[model samples]
Target: MNGRWAVGLVAGSGTPSERIAAELRRRIVAGELALGARVPSTRRITREWGVAMATATKVLNRLRDEGLVRAVPGVGTVVAGKPAPAAGRSREPQRVSPRASQRMAERMPEQAPEPASRREARPEAESTGARRVRAGGERDLTRERIVATALRVADQEGLTALSMRRVATDLGVATMSLYRHVPGKDDLLRLMMDVAFGEQPLPEPPASDWREGLETVARVQWRIYRRHPWLASTMSFTRPVLAPDAALHTERSIAVLAGRGLSWEEMAQASVALAAFVCGLAVHFEREAQAEQDSGLSAEEWMDRVEGEDHERLTADPERFPMFDAMNRGPEIDLGLEALFEFGMARMLDGIGLLIEQRGGEGGGLARGSANK
Candidate 1:
């Protein structure tokens, strides 16, 4: 396998199933398996590879995990196309700063034309009572208010339920009026993510410990996902939201690690890993919560069904699979999801700590390799 795919797979390796998963991923990325081609069925893979059914299932899941393949209901698993580049990739849409606006106008003189239309200003209405003296008129709706209301709706319902019409109805305004605030769904979602990031209470730097600082940030992010379950589904790593608050959080995270003496490359990798860990955990948590709500079955009850099958499998093979037998004997696995998150986060931080120490010994500066710094 190429180094890139090898590294990708190694990062996720922990079990035999995971190792098989890694190999499958390596194959897919290396183009050993073509795009749009169907992956081998579980039975075919099991017979061909001489692995168990569970292992084959895990392999397929791993491909799905990396977004390599997707199931088409009755059609089975087929490879997914690589995503196209985002429309805004080339020209980053910046907030209209005075300097930027001036530069644009200079470049395109036609855009500097006089204002073409005007709305008739409303005449001031006569005030009526003591209440009018005490209170101001209804606050004019702004972009912030529009985004806040949209976020609230997304929090209560999933992102799938959020729409321009729905938000307009909630705000007691005509649907066309919303266009004056937010142009479309994409614009609203971007603003909502920005507002959500703004809600986090970031600590002032030089944090006591880098790990602790990161953990705090991750926990705050977890809280956001817990409150707004749709967030996990909406967030995109490839097309990051460039809102000021979101950018500030990224800046803070990098600053926390700078104290550790890590190089720019190391810090960048660490940042990506930290984000993936939090997002991955949140996705699973949201999925489990949704499953419970949909089925009305507690987590324990769901585990019981899997445990029963595991028990039956153990009875059939006590000698051939000693590891499986031992696992069965151990305390019921809660998937160790919470513990896994902490453990993985700590391990990643520990690796960064070691790198920091190495860089410190070499008398290297934190900003030496970073572009943003």
Candidate 2:
């Protein structure tokens, strides 16, 4: 890795991440950036290097992967101890002494707590209670790490269990420190939603068949909701999260319907309808997860305990509900969410197909004759 960095730097040619990582690496090895001192954060890196957030994230990730730096909750990313002396180099720079390192760390400016009056002036800031400093001395913390940790917490524990304190506890940082990067829980949730939606990217050149494209979009959302069961609850149909990546899903849906012999209104409704169906069905996922967690029983087990009594009650009046009794006696139905999602998606697409056909049949020489061809 050192050899690669040397060559890349000397040649002045490499990916943005490589060049940036090399620069940071040089600072760490030279002891220009002292051990345990906070390194430039992702935001700082973006500002200093003028790189995109994605590229900045990659640079930090590469540094992390190489073990040159580590993220300290509340403090941000800092140099991970001092780099070891290179082998067989008599001229190698001497490692900074512990005393000198301590002095350097002390010389680094600390971030004082924000004043209460100042915090109160921010309209969106919610009171997260009195802040507590981390037990251990401050380590480096970063917004990227905070968001990633918050995402994990939401995924495992569900959103209701999430809070600024919850994330701070998980990060081993003071609750107030998070406010520096994320203003409040609302902003944190938005960042989490953005990261989640950006996980899957749209296909280049897109699918030629509108049906295929729409199906792809629906399935992608289903998979995303399945992975983050709590994601469905965060979404709003009317007042959606201001996440650009999430909006791309809607764009893709509408793009496929372009020139499909439908009015602008019809196209817009079709896109929204597809999203509504997916979100409506997906709500069950988080609810079921929470139910299982709280009740300590899987859906099947919960149903098993109740089904016997319910079945008997319904079957007792067999003549009144003959078909219901017979069907229950026959095969066990797969009413699982995954099964329902598939059934709903197929049926929804069928409805959309009918709408397209109906629009084609309307008077005034067809809205777009190309749809039939």
Candidate 3:
């Protein structure tokens, strides 16, 4: 927010975020940064300060916690007001003109002091508790709001980065206040999972044939998993999470196979198989994203590093592993996840088709396998 020239110089030492935060605090205290003035956005801070997004977000969040900057729903993070003049800083109270006060008032809710009893009774805020509570004041805490915020955090920052404290920080509420709506992390996750699935219900399959219908259903699931990469990792095949919206996927899958001559076991097996395949591949999406965040290298960049290695080059040598060597020379070597998904899907459908045909499309205890075999 300072100026455009600071973009590339993001390098720093011991906790640069803290340094940036201190500087902003100073600016707010001085009146050089006016009350109700728009502050730098996290993205602007990241690019301008040469810091990571997390660092930038931390900067804003720290200011919010101190009641220096407040989130204005449709607007954004803005300077809350000059901090109360501290000792040695100034003797008099910082004055605000009526117009400036009104604008600032519109941007922020009035703050209320925490009740003495509750303040003394509360336990220390831990990392898990950090994301959930907003400091005392402003109102508007609801379970729906909390879960939605949690989902947003998971969607944008990955699930590992999501916590009650993080969500509360974004909501501009005390972390402890979130517990009033959602019980705990496990409960939050259950709510988040249900919301994610329920929010995007699968529409009825429009294909004429059963195989096409199955493909349609499977692709819908695949797309949903792709949209929320963290999703695939959270799911389990056995002892499922008991989410009703999520269960709709299986219901739809089975409904598509109605009158397809498949037995109950066959239908269930097919649904599980398709789900397993989609989820197995989709797990890589979150893993790859986490790898990028941790390593600061993209999937292509990491793979390029591998492919440039001696072992990788050795695998392509014609003298050894001839088929791999031959395959490496052409476009067929493409390893796009989408291509792999479709390839696996086609094969699974082919086997299912063969089962239907071999059993004469009905009867013969098809679910029990062929009598001759």
Candidate 4:
């Protein structure tokens, strides 16, 4: 309940739920939490320890299971060894079937096993290698591992398929256990984005001049989008996630324009402008791949398949759409993503280079217009 408990709850050794249960057990045993005193509820534990409700529930369940605490009708979860039961209540302990006992043995493996008993059905994931590893006392889990695993899942399958359960399955751990590392998918995505941007770190300056710096940054970002197609769509310039590597990328872009005679605001605009351009074009990277995969045909191939007699006749008429007919003729005229990206990258940098030469990168951001009457 105190800040001291957070030491082991957040990052110290042992699982978060185990650490909490042990702490509460120690408190109750030592009279720090006396009999009849209400222990922290699942909601309270979730808030105090910054763990998920599932983790907190597990802690309370463990405490109740150890007879260190018990639940009352009106009262909340209280310390164990309380006064005699009320008149209407029975003191007899609830029965646990042999199969249930065996299941309990399988679940709470940290405790001693109960007597041999029947085994009922188990969930497919329950008896999995993940459970086995957890049962065997493997305890080296970290936030880095969780983030890395989630990134790998996103890389293989697109970001849409990257749920916490899938990552937990890949890592051979319970879905809730991931909450102990990352709060949720948004936090995990932030970490993943940071890691992705960090993957191809820019040079100290990454460019010699303004033109070269802008080009280099855009090219590097384009390459990353190709590597992880979903990355382009995960990012947003308007509402950027607070990732260190993402910030670093922007910093380097702005830094390259230093001494180019641009104001700080102008430098920021230049950097954001280039990044936004790359992201806009890069957005189509995943969509095209997914489209081709789903339809089993390339864009050109699909067009050919869907082309009708009218389309042929329309294209054959040079007088009606002369420029269109001529431009659409060559089979080699494949305006692929890579080609477009290179072409656009060159043109954008050219425009930026022209701006730098003309304005000397001076401030010209949105001249405040007079109010409309």
Candidate 5:
């Protein structure tokens, strides 16, 4: 406990309560405090650490704030299970095989130079084929190839670098050839979004449970946006493309929620709310991903920069933002999408749950009246 407390103490410094909270946070992250382990009570922590009750409260609050602890009805604050690891971090590192290394060596360029005659002849041979193709190549280009090349370019350099000319050049075709496939940039974008969204497998209609169905659709959409970071901005809420795959997803979502006894209006409103939550989250995540890709800054690095800027702003105008200053004094405030989504989802579900219960009670009362009649 002393060694652990020492590590915690060193990590905790700055604000008295924050230091205490940090130490506790370290324990949780370090796996020293296993998930579901009962953290010491406020009074016990105060006495054990020789800190005030206020300090202990702050420490617990910080842990709860970070989703590391939960308070059950009868149980005091208890540690929460570790959140699922971020995508792609849980897998083992891929190792190249010895056979692949041997294959690579076999394909390596020769060190010796080719004969002068062969070198001179190679260009002539290639030029003959190029000239023949140039005369007859106009008819060989197709819409599929253009779209396929455009997708490849987007996959490599991102959607921002994609253009008709770029796709045509990649395919060794004229830019006008692409017009047969896509009318313009906007048309290409619509087609591209449809293609990407189509990649998401729609769940079977009439899911066994509403929550399971909603979660499935939400997770699928989330993964799509995660892979295609540009999809968030490209997708339109008001005028979503009525692609078959997209329509199937919408149909499945509605079918699942149909059993909830909600009126058509209520069901539609709830569906919109859920979709908005998922889209908002995807947009936020994509923005962060793009920022990281462009700036080469990790999340922690971005947080550091933000905190530094906030500190400077606070010092420059203490009188203007008293509440912000007070909040800044506490643990690092994370107003990230993860937190926002969790808060919104919990409240939204709670409201829905209450509605369902009330509907059930009303239905039950009507049943009793009918039985009496």
Candidate 6:
């Protein structure tokens, strides 16, 4: 069907479904849609016009009410070969039962009651205060609202529990309505990731040195992962999610690595390596949080319960592993993730600095042998 006509009718509408039904009614009346022609199903209506399933169903029901269509056993709803009712005329009003009217009021609170004369004739159709309640329940539903709701769900429950339906429930809308805003769950996830990365932006005028720039990017990502524990698992090394905001972290890292007398390949590898390191460690953030919640014990407390026994068992055979015993002979070591991240980052940067020094040697990238092979 031509969708342009529906755009013009949007401002002249009763509801979204009514506008769509009017367009289809025009088609049936004008013979643009031939007799016995298949009418657009609810799925097609949603795909074509980007409306919720409830709205699409209403569209079909409106056409059926107008005697312009009928449902075939298996072929789907089709145009009924009936003469068109004259313009400005409609079928006689059907009396609605109180139970059905109540249900309608519950679902469609925006609908006003029938005229007082009609209600006097059929008191069952009267809906008490229906127009005053829930008139704008979904009026503020925007792409931003959907994305924000999904982000909160993922942050609190992890990616495994985050779904389009879950977000719609949180927003108190139909599940299919979310599809009108976001294409699907994958697209929603991409949006969520972009929002997460954009939350803490890289500083302006990039860090002074390459090391500082990388550290700044890494720490910023760490903080993001810490805030939204589920974000780390969404990151990938082989198949990177192409979120523009997330790429800014890499862009800043690579920019600082530029003009450092390093090869382009080396710069790329270093940038990815730094990001991968941060993400790799950050993966534990959600896992640890989940573990603590499930087991009702913090990391330190859990370790305290088993540390002595494990330590004694390992040291019991210290002679078989002298270096291990020698290292533990000193005061207890701090194995916190923060300390490990700091120490590992310093060591990794030290190694990268060594690579930079070696790159300045005889063979450029291959001071000892070919950097590639």
lDDT of 6 by residue, 110-151 (tens): 222344463333212113301121234367778989999888
**Which window of 10 residues has the lowest lDDT sum in candidate 4?**
364-373
- Model 6 spans with C-alpha error above 4 angstroms: 1-135, 361-373
In candidate 5 the C-alpha lDDT for residue 38 amounts to 55
lDDT, candidate 1, 176-287, per-residue tens: 7778878898989888877787787676654666666666777777777666667777776787767787666566677777756676887777776787778777776656
Give the Cα error of residue 178 in candidate 2, in Å. 1.3
Each prediction's TM-score versus the true structure: 0.56, 0.60, 0.61, 0.58, 0.54, 0.60
Error of 5 at 187 (Å): 2.7
lDDT of each candidate versus the true structure: 0.59, 0.70, 0.68, 0.66, 0.59, 0.69
**Is candidate 3 or 4 superior in lDDT?**
3
List the candidates ranked by TM-score, beginning with the highest: 3, 6, 2, 4, 1, 5
Please give the clash total of every predicted structure, in order: 0, 6, 17, 0, 1, 0
Instruction: Judge candidate 1 at residue 171 and give its lDDT.
Output: 55
| Model 1 ranges off by over 4 Å | 1-140, 319-321, 361-373
Per-residue accuracy of model 4 over 1-373 as CA lDDT, tens digit each: 5766685566867788988887776676566875556677666677788888778766865565445565432234555442223566333222344565466447543222222231111112232223333442126678898888787656644665567876665465678878888999999999998888889988773666666677778888988887777899999888889999888878888888787666788779978988898888888877765555445457778777876664577787889978767766756465778788777766666655556666655431222231110
Model 5 has an lDDT value of: 0.59
Give the number of the best model, judged by lDDT: 2
Give the total clashing residue pairs for model 2: 6
Clashing pairs in 5: 12-19
- The runs of at least 3 residues in candidate 4 whose Cα sits more than 4 Å from the true structure, single-residue gaps closed, are 1-138, 298-320, 361-373
